[model samples]
Target: MRQLYLNQAALSARATTVIRDADNQSRYLLVGKWGLRADVLTVYLIDGSLEAEVKQESLGLLPRFRLLYHRQPVGHVSKTFGVIREVLFVRGLNWVIMGNLNSGRFRIFHGRELIANIAPVSADGQTIALEVDQPDHEALVVCLAAILDRWAKHQQRGLNPLKNRGWAPGLSSEVTPFITQEKNLDRRY
Candidate 1:
């Protein structure tokens, strides 16, 4: 049950973003970029170690991403269309990520059991808290949070976030149209 926070924009995920702990100290980084053949994304430690990675399974058909830990497949993340719009596959855990488009809050669940929470995203950054029963899935949960945040940002722009993945420091989004989710859509009675 390690507590962590995300204070960066995922839609800018083409590069990298530094994540920190509750003390505002840098813990790890989330990176989404291009590989030699296709898109590549992963999380790393400050000492430069691989925590988790994303590998595309098929390019022609539905985009499916495998979550790799130390070069081994542990889980996967796939895009889907639905009324509530479910996305992200939590591999071995068999969990799916879904949230209110109107609310910044997103929850991870293993069937009916609540796993983690990502919420209170501000102009500064988004925060993630994990309560998974297994400790090993920490990194995987973080990556899922990034994927969801990036996906949501793209949704506001009327496009697919999977098509453009990159985020980090010292990168101006002007090169690519970047829009961060600011406020929830207000409804009138």
Candidate 2:
């Protein structure tokens, strides 16, 4: 297990486990932070299952991104760049949201590669929304929606199906719905 810290505050004490999918070479993990706070900090691992050769380092970091739920502040999520608008793990893809403030473009990255980009939809001191390209772009969004839904359920009930090793229904179900929806949407166009 590995320890994760945020600003010297212990975020997660146990090392998050990363599971690999043999079919597509994708990696998955579950990460959460426990503390005396009103909100829970959680992140679903969506990519990079590769073992850490070093002692302990974050897989990625994002310098200037904020997470919002329905216009309310959720928490901060990071990527390798600096700050990320969002991070989605679906099937075998890791979708990372990046913004180019100077160009007014919002870009999505799969691993280290650029996958898509769209114009900025909205932004303020606290949050930013980017218009994702539809149909094809729906895959990432749907995956994130599924993750968020499951995460909310887990937080409320104190149970996470993804924590199970052999019969992880949360991960399977969360991914399947998004894939099916995205496929259907793709077939439509």
Candidate 3:
């Protein structure tokens, strides 16, 4: 397994951040661009080549996003409207994310194979630990992790007024927003 660390504080505070390995070696550069409705996160290899990119497609309770690898749409990651657990569907890759995702701690699987594990985010919400099973998937995993971290932070901010209430075609909140059991959970892409 390969261990990696991301500075959550840097990622949230700046436009660009550096991702490091267990030995503190610079592995990739993460750059985020905030958009009116959608945000984009791009990852670049240490040598200055593009690794991957995740772009947001929609907002509200069930956020949607698409992932690009080699500048091609590889798949999409979207939140499911679940009341008990926060579930995300990775369409193209067929990846499953389980465990405490709202807290930034979870295991990722490609079908039946475990591919990566993200340690519970630090108490200060400033660091994230990632253990990936394969070296080739390192960049992709890191990029995905960043999106997860961003969403987690958004959840932490608590947009109750807009999130708690649902807007439907009629004059009623009959369409309730999907609620996760955990309060501190958030996500982005």
Candidate 4:
């Protein structure tokens, strides 16, 4: 099981997530595209090394995401039955991200073990907090959070966020703040 935290949150694909250890020393910088020019998610270690790359594989009911470490396939995070997100780690430490995108609340799990939970820490929905059990897996875990985070937004709206959105270096439309409208779907029992 992994328990960690993602603090100082902001609404940006090119993000910097703070993970405070017992002494508050580690941080994970989410480096990726924030515009339409690129399509990739890279999590770089603080020491200036590529930790993991999350690439979108396909577009469908549940889009598939591939985790590449050292240019090798490590695991796969995909939507299960067009609903919950499942992360199957081939190496070790598999996780599952479950939530309702409508509410924007998600939880990470290692099998049945709860690893982390993500929810809006602020009323504006611009900031979020992720609580995880393992801090060492902050890079991989947070990278997955980024992926699942995108998934939640995608689930909320019928449009694909990646198709019309991206993160650039600087001075881009992505840096400009915007509003997200949530569509209220009709649920029949």
Task: Give TM-scores for every candidate, taking all chains together and pairing residue i with residue i.
Answer: 0.66, 0.21, 0.76, 0.61
Identify the runs in model 1 with alpha carbons over 4 angstroms from their true place.
10-13, 34-37, 58-62, 86-91, 121-134, 159-189
Error of model 4, residue 31, in angstroms: 0.8
Model 1 over residues 56-91: C-alpha lDDT tens digits?
565532466677887788787767655246555566
lDDT of 3 by residue, 1-189 (tens): 988888877777856888889899999898876433567888899999998888889877767888898799988987776443555657898887776656678788988898999875578767888899987777778777877776776776565555445553454656656657455454431
**lDDT by residue for model 2 over 1-189, one digit each (tens)?**
111111111112334533223243323343443222223323344653221111111222212233433334333333333423234322234455554333334456667766555332324211112234443333233223222333333344444444634346555553443356887889899
Model 2 score (lDDT):
0.34
Which residue runs does candidate 2 get wrong by more than 4 Å? 1-77, 80-92, 96-98, 111-116, 121-189
Runs of candidate 3 exceeding 4 Å displacement: 121-123, 159-189
Sequence-dependent TM-score of model 4: 0.61
Candidate 4 on 1-189: residue-level lDDT in tens? 433445424425355554444345565556764323226777676777777777777776656777777567777766666432333332244766666665667776777887777766667776566676665555666667676566566556545454446544353664676445332333331
**lDDT for predicted candidate 1 compared with the true structure:** 0.64
What is the clash count for each candidate, in the order shown?
A: 11, 9, 5, 12
Candidate 1 has what TM-score? Answer: 0.66
lDDT of 3 at 92: 95
